[model samples]
Target: MTFSLRRMLYEDRYKLILAACQDIRRHREEVAKTVIASQLLDALDVDVPSDALLSHIVAESLLRRIDRNLLSGRNLYLQVEKRPQIDLFTLLQRAIPAVPQGYALANQYLVHAMRQSSTPTLLEIGIGKGLQVVALLRALARDPGKIERIRVIALDPNRTALTEGVAAIDEVRAELPFDIEIYPLVKLIEVCEDADYAHFEALAEGSLSINAAYTLHHTTGPDSDARTRLLRRLRALKPRVFTLVEPSSDHDTEHLTRRMHHCWQHFATVFDLVDRSDASPDEKFAIKEGFFGREVRDILGTSDAFRCERHETLESWLLRLKKSGFVPYPEIELDVDLPEYCRSSVSSGLVRLSYRSVPIIAVFAFAGEAG
Candidate 1:
């Protein structure tokens, strides 16, 4: 067979599987859905090393099928209260290095934003378990003379996350030479009102900084303007610097085929990194199934209204930040080590972390229009 013909055949198979999924979504013929499910399961039996992406798609489709039938006619994403899968999630994140690298890079600007102040306050959006905030506090503590006291206004929709994140931050407080105060807010960015911004502004004493790592994309709205509106509200708070880190994919799209393609391309790099990690096989399986697999399920399986993992491209984020009256805040390059296969680049005042040649995560800093 000619190479072109083989490529064409390969794409056709993927399209056929996707069409099967759409048919299941639209016309729920149990027999047809079962056949498609069986085909996907059989496809997973193939062990070609280069077919990892294809294998993951098949596996994800199977999970979505199970979710549809097993959830009593309700989408699982809507019904279940998601708890933090911390250990495996951290393992997967550490293995990839993109998340940690983004955290480190964002911390650089976050610390820089507060270096000159005697009293620094941070308004961290979606401060999940305070991982990044704890890291940022530690970085700030390195120069105890510059900063005497710090306050953190942590916001997250997950009550459990907010509670535990506050505890984690407090644990580090006793060890630091500076005084630490934390105010935890259990709220979503979409629903935060003017009172919330006023409260945040009132909390500031000297310098204020904002950091949203792997957050903000979760802000779902009735329309696309939800994120922009939230950013505008945040801009009004007038933090010295705002740093954001988000996945470099467009899974927020309503089109399933496009979402599937983007998810496959983006997660393939992530899963490949997990596969290469020195982690135990069971650990990797847990990370892939428990952490990343759930993300895949939410993206591909749930209804548009119920879906929460709304990721977008770096370009789209830049446009939204500009629309909300933000200008790029530059950072000094750090001398941090990365995995041999990973690469980092700084361009247009944005730092992009990539696996092989595909960009996976983007980190950038911006200031409000006045600043």
Candidate 2:
């Protein structure tokens, strides 16, 4: 059998690095011991070492920037090599260096919201491998007496993701004495109309706590009424609390140049932080390229359906929410006690953080009027 290699575009370079990072992070020891193939090195546009460290390959790739095609995701490592592909959800878990800190922040809000409920019901959108579920359950585990049982409605388009997420939250059942039940809804919010949300809203059983982490931006255009319509849809759920987590950037412009600049400025700050993180060079590359890098492509590459990654700050999100009948929940700091992983990821940097230094992700808690 003969196989032909796919030609990679310059825009695919960062994506290639993302693939390389995911692969190396998954097989660190193997990469450290062997002389990786010339084909691999050429594929990544990096030099080959006699005994190569994946970290070294990642560092070398970062030295150069892609010149053409701007940003594209194509012929990804798994696609080219036919390797056991990394699940985007699981890879995101491993690739995002600061996600734990972000998750911890969201978990605190989950605890606060659930503590107020008679029977806590959490509706998490973008249930990617159940990362948010883990955070919510962990927070509940910390305060077992707050609620007797928690019902989670996890929504995503992928059934595999539902399976993975259900399995993850199921573990919390063993840790907490309270009954934990997870209902996975396989649907994408992008296509859903106001009435479509009724299905999940019906399952709320009572006052609901809705959590949409990094998922709302994809639901509609930044300036479109669709944004408000979407907000109204969630508001109609009569949520007791809504936990929102989004990137702290405004990449919603129509101008290609403006989008490109915002994309650069945003990821530049992020990549700089990744460079400073105590994570190994390979892990840093993966976080930057595999995880955040894909975001850069999403913002710059296309504006087609669901390819929309329109990010807006907390202030911007609030503007829409307030217009749509959602009001602020009682303000709670809920400062995350950043674990060593987070501390290390943000550590070893000498740059004094000024206006340029900002949190990559922000968490907000809000609520809408009851029906």
Candidate 3:
């Protein structure tokens, strides 16, 4: 079946199952398990609804081995080894447009910086699931003829993330035909402090540019000595452009009104678009309350380091580039449109009650000519 047709059918199935779930007299756990299975199927783009029966059987079998009561509680994670493949990748892709406007702007500036430079090599730090890397690859793939010998390097401490990303790339390799080369560097062989200029020199010897998405925050806290050590190393590498993207909201503030507003808007949209009338209000609420809000809050709340640093701000980061001997350029804006579901999340107080704030910016810098 074609993708469009499959999507329509899946939508109908989702609605049907949701309707079934609303009947409290029915086995709620069974309904929930079936619905979760269906969602996984939809995400995988599997054309066969019959396949979902197998998934349900698998879920039932797994639940039976764990505990009969557990199945009724709708704990699908215990039964599933992997996240629904569709949700995993789709979630990552969804983040692209949600990237704060600043990040996109920085990317444009980096592009301009690369055009002016004699050589352009791209590097991405913290290559999580390769969503951003894929985004970059997609762009390069579009103009394969224009780019000559593009070398993309991704660095991460997690072997699984890199491995999974490489696997994902391999899966799409045929569809995204590009000559651009991607190098996955899964190990940070040495700590930044212990490393000397020679270490950075070796890393940047060939790369003319570098970009990091949500990685720098993980590397060090704003006040930690590690931050300076990492910064010195970054400066030493002397890439033409160094860019970072992080949550734009202020971390110090527990109450972020604007972000809260956005979250509320997001939740409402999700309920309106994704929830079905057949689904019990409780089931729909659980999906929204237990799944979406909890997950986002956990992600955004874990780090104050990204937000605490002055450089986390787009303007401050640009200024730092100049201070670090890189000529600063006018800021560019990424302007990611938050999904309506995200907007709706605000009213739920997930941002204020859970995350404490909302992320809001992207920052970039360009190196000054080598002295």
Candidate 4:
């Protein structure tokens, strides 16, 4: 029966993972670390493996203090959903040496675009903590005298994160002179269709624009016709600019072996940053397990349509946008002289220019003559 075959395969993988853990005890080689990390990322993608599972994984895989310290936290899924611990991930993104430099990269684009328009309708997809956006609004407020007003439409499948984001924005409304109205809509962009966008026109007012920081990759596919459809809908809205912040790797593929390799390489760099950081042990573990670990699990454990963390590269992104009728801002080759801070970030290995050209976080102006 099919069930029997599935059970046999699962048992075989569990045995292999356990055996790999054993191998790590005897030899601390590059292969051993990769095996353990790959298996653990696999186990973590779907659900929290048992304490016994973690025990075996830790005993053989990590450094002494790190092994003991990593297990001291709650399950990866539960811990991140807590409103208070959300700050841990935020700190990792904005403060800790974050490679790809998502926090500041997106903020710069938003600030620059905001300055260009008197009343730009800023729409965001998957606004998690509302930290960077709030920072942006504050930066704009330094002008003080302009009666600035903009509408923010925060769309996310998780209403809880949206609620948290809205609450965070409300807390800062007093400090800024800008009048802003935030509308929270719950929808998965990948699955959403042309009909769903009927309301988008009404929501967008003034010089419409977008600020999507670390969220667009969740769309169901870099495959199927799904990605094309989604991009077309976005293009139809015709925002002044679409700012994207995403990882610069091929994590969205369905191939598990390739996925694990990409995951290991990407997270290794991230974990190194955590090790170098002044963040507390708990904070570091939270970023490692809750944020990065969840991304691995979501990418590997779920089918493409169901996965929460599907990501694509800049090349693929440009192609898809063009297919849907859009183009990268300025020209691909015409380099915008990034601020000295952005250039300096590359030395720390926190951010890098793609193709030795642009930052990992890029803003694409929709190439449409009208917004």
lDDT of each: 0.74, 0.58, 0.44, 0.56
Q: Give the best candidate by TM-score.
A: 1
Measured on C-alpha atoms, candidate 2 has an lDDT of: 0.58
Q: Put down candidate 1 lDDT per residue, 1-371, tens digits, no spaces.
A: 01221222135545555565565556654644554444332222213332343444454454464444532343223222334566556777757888888999888888877877888899988887888888888888886547888989999988998998999998898678788888899998779888888888888864788889888888888798888988888887778888999999999987665676677667666777777888776566566656776787788767788988889999899999999988888556665557888898887548888886878899978986554
- Summing lDDT over every window of 10 consecutive residues in candidate 1, give the lowest-scoring window: 1-10
What's each prediction's TM-score?
0.84, 0.69, 0.49, 0.67
**Candidate 3 lDDT tens digits, 85-120:** 324434433332333333454465456545443335
Each model's Cα RMSD: 5.3, 11.8, 13.6, 10.2
Task: Please report the TM-score between candidate 1 and the true structure.
Answer: 0.84
Give candidate 2's total backbone clashes. 0
- Compose the digit string of candidate 4's lDDT tens values, residues 108-223: 55565566666666777777767767877787787533337867877778888878888988999998777888878887666666665666667665466676666777665555
What's the best-to-worst order under lDDT? 1, 2, 4, 3
lDDT (Cα, 0-100) at 73 in candidate 3: 47
- Whole-model lDDT, model 3: 0.44
